[model samples]
Target: MKIKMKKFGVLLFAFLGLVSCSDDDDANVDPPFEGQSKSYDLTEVGESGVSGTATFDENEDGSVTITLDLDGTSEGVMHPAHIHFNSAAEGGEIALSLEPVDGDTGISETTVEMLDDKETEISFEDLMDFDGYINVHASADDLETLVAQTDIGGNALTGESVSYDLAEVDVEGVSGTATFYERENGETLVELDLEGTTEGNSHPAHIHMGSVEDAPGDIAITLTSVDGASGMSFTNVAMTDGTDDEEGTAVSYEDLIAYDGYINVHASADNLATLAAQGNIGANATEE
Candidate 1:
């Protein structure tokens, strides 16, 4: 299921002109946190999917500034993307959508004012304390229609993690419920679980880029299903540096399979490991 991000006020009028300006002027003030936009081709990372660019900047409050470039895709394209709440080795959710780009590249741009000072001020409610990374998703042409994914920008909260649950069962003629949620001490923790509903069976059952999709680069590691485990289980996988796999043995929340993750158990009735229903584990999941 896709969740639409509420459109707010448009205040980035001089973004382009300010790209070259310095956030600080006293020469030694070191300037407030500042960042730049980075361009990349999804194909370079075994994504062979498409092209896009993401811009990152330091907000006046210490958080981050983000701009997305659809590289030429259109809005109504129905791709999913988001900012995972935590930065753990486990996984997360799509906090928002990647507004499609305009012109030939389908490049779209937008900015966010962040506040990296407090944690209780999470969510985009206050523009002063939500310190999290910005991730993008690629629209996959799958039956589940999960946007195959990839992280385009921002730093995933390394200290934050998530809770994974086989929240739902009854898909592709299968019935089982296995879920587990555990977070490492001092690690990022973003809560994500499948809601019980006709959301559809045979989704790429694995860790996606905080969003639903089968694109590229965003498949943070794949989850493995033990022989006949029913129900869910939780693991306090540790994540260091908000990247994919840096903690003891747990997978880094930022490690996309492209870096050494896996997705298995397809959704097909035949091999039962078709592209869909496949449990793709992003990076590595360290044991608690």
Candidate 2:
């Protein structure tokens, strides 16, 4: 009976020690927080054809991790990504630098204990108060050009889809369709699809001030030139009255609906004087 009692006590002590270690492990584990994540859907900027999502995660180690999953970039190209101060519409300055995004996978993962120019660690709660945005540049060499971006905590775009039909001007059998998509970021993406165009030629296209009545009054916004082989052009509208000095125009989508305009597709870049095709757009536009 004594031998049996001593064996039973030893077993009980081992069990208690195991339980104490288990409790210690449990105490070190971090609790899950339901509202510790923030997600933002990014969009294309400056005709870069890039779009993606940025997710910010608050880790248990007091560090914030940001993951960016993107698309519409060439493989093997590296892009510079950063957190900027203020909204995208306001063209904010970079506040925090992040790891360069890889083009092959289009993924950027970065962690932050604080901003690049700051010293103190920033909490997840305090980061929510950050009046900032994220902007992905074309590359390390071209930081001024933005490819994909989004406002962190700002108003989104809710607008309409508008399209127009083009007719042959001086060039026969040259025509196209121009579609304007109002993006969630309040920018307009104009895509031109043309047919019966010369295979080796490039067509310069633009949004003009007038319609059939005016016959290309003035160039309002320059568009991406259409490739002859694909007969397609995709550009973000910058209604700046076709000036070399103007950065961007003040024209909004609301103003576009009430403005009179048209589209002009030229035969070549050097031959802007000759129009291959033209279309009435905006207030005078005809929908099909």
Candidate 3:
């Protein structure tokens, strides 16, 4: 009886030891991660018809995982992609390279802990404030042809915008709208969309110093020439064109919304006197 009782006590001690070890192990284990994510729309470039969403996922380990899921991608073609260091309208050099998207699946995933230089550490938070844009090329050979693109981070549009009507001046039926879009970085994107522009002609557009009610003034800023074929022009405005006393002076979206200026679209570069469209913007804009 004494030996049996001693064995039973030894068994109880082992059981308690096992329970203590289990509790210690549970205490040392790390908890599951709860992180955040952001998604940006990737618009189709030109007529490529490929568009999708780019998602940046924050990992518990402080890395960023970028996933691109696209539609309308051609099978058997590997598309190259990169993060460029500026607004899409104002193109800049590549800041980071991503994995080539598999055309068959129309998907790509990359875990980025640092920039392309491999020295600049980029966390998920850093990417949210990055001044960059993403471009997915058609293929390795056709780098100039973009399949999908989006302005991310600071260059993304803030959804605050103002538009002014560009009425026909010298040309009949040549008129459109000039829109100023606010960027997240406080810059502005000036877009000119016109109608009835002659095909194969490029129209010079500019922001003059004064309103149209006043006499024509000197150019305050130069804008991208309107493409007659597409009847579109996109210019990223960060500063004055340095044409006046405030040459290369810094400008913001806030400044332009209250600016005393007018926009003019000429018939062509050579015929500045022949206006295709004209419009008063900012403080001079009519309530209508």
Candidate 4:
């Protein structure tokens, strides 16, 4: 009977040792997310030459550092930068204020532990879960004017797309699709695919300043001319004033949320007065 009891005690001790070992292994397992870092492409907005990238890195201490780098800014100008509470498309409120970027050098380094509202203390992991974006204003005095920006973290458009169906205008049997690809470079690439048009003639396309409801405005961005033979035009565009002299306008994808903009395709390079096709763009524009 003593031998039997001793054997049972030994078995029990072995089982307990196994359980302890399992618990230790579980404790050593790393978390699903220990750290995170993301880079956002900032596009030109309005007339400001501001454009760059915002990189957010999570530190071991749980704080976040935002590094802003840009180009095409005027020397001696100060641009106000911020981290807003939502995606650029949604136009969110300011959640955190970053160090203002120098327009001349186009750089800003900001460390954040709390929000601009000051009611909330935000950590790097918190920012990863938060829906937010970065915005660079034209100047400190012109806070309302956004010159460059991009969505951050999960707010970014990954593998997403937007399109507009163009209609025949002035010229019958001429139409196309205006598709915008949200690229990682912080610039939207627009592809114009047209049909019912002649070959060997280049068609000038522009994103105008108005919608169909208000009649198309002047050229906002001059897109790459469509190939007469292929009926396709591809342009990696920064919003502009539709001039060769100017590039990368302050208009961005976020501005398209309520933008009164439209796409206009001219009949031919020489026939700039004639429209081959036209379509409203952005949230206010006709969507397919």
Top candidate when judged by TM-score against the true structure: 3
**Span of ten consecutive residues with least summed lDDT in model 4:** 249-258
List, residue by residue over 1-288, the lDDT tens digit for candidate 3: 999999999999999999999999999998888888999999998899999999999998899999999999988999999999988998999999999999999999999999989899999888988999999999999998999999998888999999999999999999999999999889999999999997899999999988998957988899999999989999999998764354588999999999999999999989989999999999889987
RMSD of 2: 9.5
Residue range 1-288, candidate 1, lDDT tens digits: 122222221234356446535543445476554443343232212232444555555445644445555543445553444555533223455444445334354545545442223233322233223323344444444223322233322322223433222312224443333223222223223222332223333333344443223433344433433222232222233432235555334543444322243233334335443432223233333334
Q: Which candidate is the best by lDDT?
A: 3
lDDT of 2 by residue, 130-222 (tens): 666788989889887889987663323344777788888888888988877665445566779899887889999888787778674877887
TM-score for each model: 0.32, 0.55, 0.87, 0.50
**Residue pairs in candidate 4 whose N, alpha carbon or C atoms collide under 3 angstroms:** 45-250, 46-250, 46-251, 239-249
lDDT by residue for model 4 over 64-179, one digit each (tens)?
99989998887898888988875665467888999988877889999888898777889876776677788898787788898898777655655656888889989888898888
In model 2, the Cα lDDT at residue 142 comes to 87
lDDT value for candidate 2? 0.79
Q: Whole-model lDDT, candidate 4?
A: 0.79
Query: What's the ranking of the predictions by TM-score, best on top?
Result: 3, 2, 4, 1
Query: After superposing candidate 2, which stretches have Cα over 4 Å from the reference?
Result: 1-53, 56-64, 69-108, 112-159, 196-200, 242-249
RMSD of each: 21.0, 9.5, 4.6, 12.3
After superposition, the stretches of candidate 3 with alpha carbons farther than 4 Å from their true spots are 1-32, 243-247
Deviation of model 1 at 235, angstroms? 12
